[model samples]
Target: MCHTSGVSSERAAHLLRLSALFQAAPAADVQALAELARLRTLRRGDVLFHQGDAATHLYVVESGWLKVSKLAAHGQREVVLHLSGPRQMVSGVSVFVDNARYSASAAALEDAGVLTLSAEAVRHQTAQSPALAQAVIAHFAKRHVELLERFDDLLFSDLNARLARLLLEHAPPGTTLLLPTNSELAAHLNTVPELVSRKLGEFYRQGFISLERRTVRIVDEAALRSLGGP
Candidate 1:
């Protein structure tokens, strides 16, 4: 059972501030959408939805992190998706598709908050706003393109190269990068933690990088680039 009573007028107004979902929606449509949503908070390690569970609602993260993963045939869980930080839309594609069950399970990486809108409510709002419908379609299309790129990277790039690229892209603009834990880094890079740690050690020995706990400092950016090939 989920709670929906904490969403006051202020919180409801803040929910309407989600630009991604209601970018082109009219004021009335935004209000209606917000009204139809239920707010829920999740603690770290909480399972928001399990694989094959009915996908009744789409989620928007207001804060914290969520990881979407699926169990492989080998009895290991593989993280295929991640939503870190705020204002992320979760599992929106499944709402319009024929599949009712969740394709992957979503778990809280940290204490998080989310607003969930029923599939029927989303459909009703989209039906009333053509712009919203088009926006949603475009959002899904962009996500598909991103997934294709990830597939290409995994197929063609080596583990070290992939890890380097991920670090550069996600790292803040600074001299040192605060990398995730080895376990979390493994999931993000689609590999095992032991392998990731080994690669980091190799990089350190080669004088190309330095690792301190979860922080990774790129000592030689040029060498890092060379590992990724031309």
Candidate 2:
């Protein structure tokens, strides 16, 4: 990770500027860390790592999307932690963990490019840069809050409410909802696939949505919003 690629300092700084994680680092630190990274490309569905894999790199999404997910006990099912888009950093905490093993897996949700920085190099940088250390701490703290928020939603919100909100956010009228399958939705909503299927059927019966193979057509936005109770 500490090895240099012999990249131009100008190019290094430009890439550093583009990454939200490193943009605020000192100029010298930016140049140093950038030299320690290499670029990688991934096609849709390519896995970056699996749970318990050695957390050797900090991946910065330069373009397209990635999904972070975890498997249930016995690997019976998987649940998404988040969908990371361009400019987002994945596994910032992985660099600092004592065991340095990824708690979740990451995969390309679409064709993508990422800057892979050596975790050892990043940890060394963090040792010298208080700002980078603080930033890493903040990233973990933010994800902690997000996990709690998701737990709160699952505990307090009804299935109708959760499905309603998801539809409102991702699948509005005239738009085809993308790759999230019923199994994925069930995993996200903390419910069973059969339950999700029944709910979708209920929505269809109520004229709130229409379904086709791998897609949901939003039909009644206002009614769906009403179903998403606060």
Alpha carbon lDDT of residue 139, candidate 1? 69
The ten-residue window of minimal lDDT in model 1 covers 169-178
Pairs of residues clashing in candidate 2: none
Residues 1-230, candidate 1, lDDT per residue (tens digit)? 33354565456547656646556566667777777777889887788899889888888888766777777777576665554446667877778755578888888766788888888788877887887778777767777898898888887888988876765544423555555567777877778999998998998899877778766777777877777665
User: What is candidate 2's TM-score against the reference?
Assistant: 0.71
Q: Note the clash tally of each candidate.
A: 0, 0
Indicate which candidate wins on lDDT. 2
Native-to-model Cα distance after best TM-score fit, residue 116 in candidate 2, in Å: 1.1
- RMSD (Cα, Å) of candidate 1? 4.3
Note each model's CA RMSD in angstroms: 4.3, 5.2
Using TM-score as the measure, the top candidate is 1
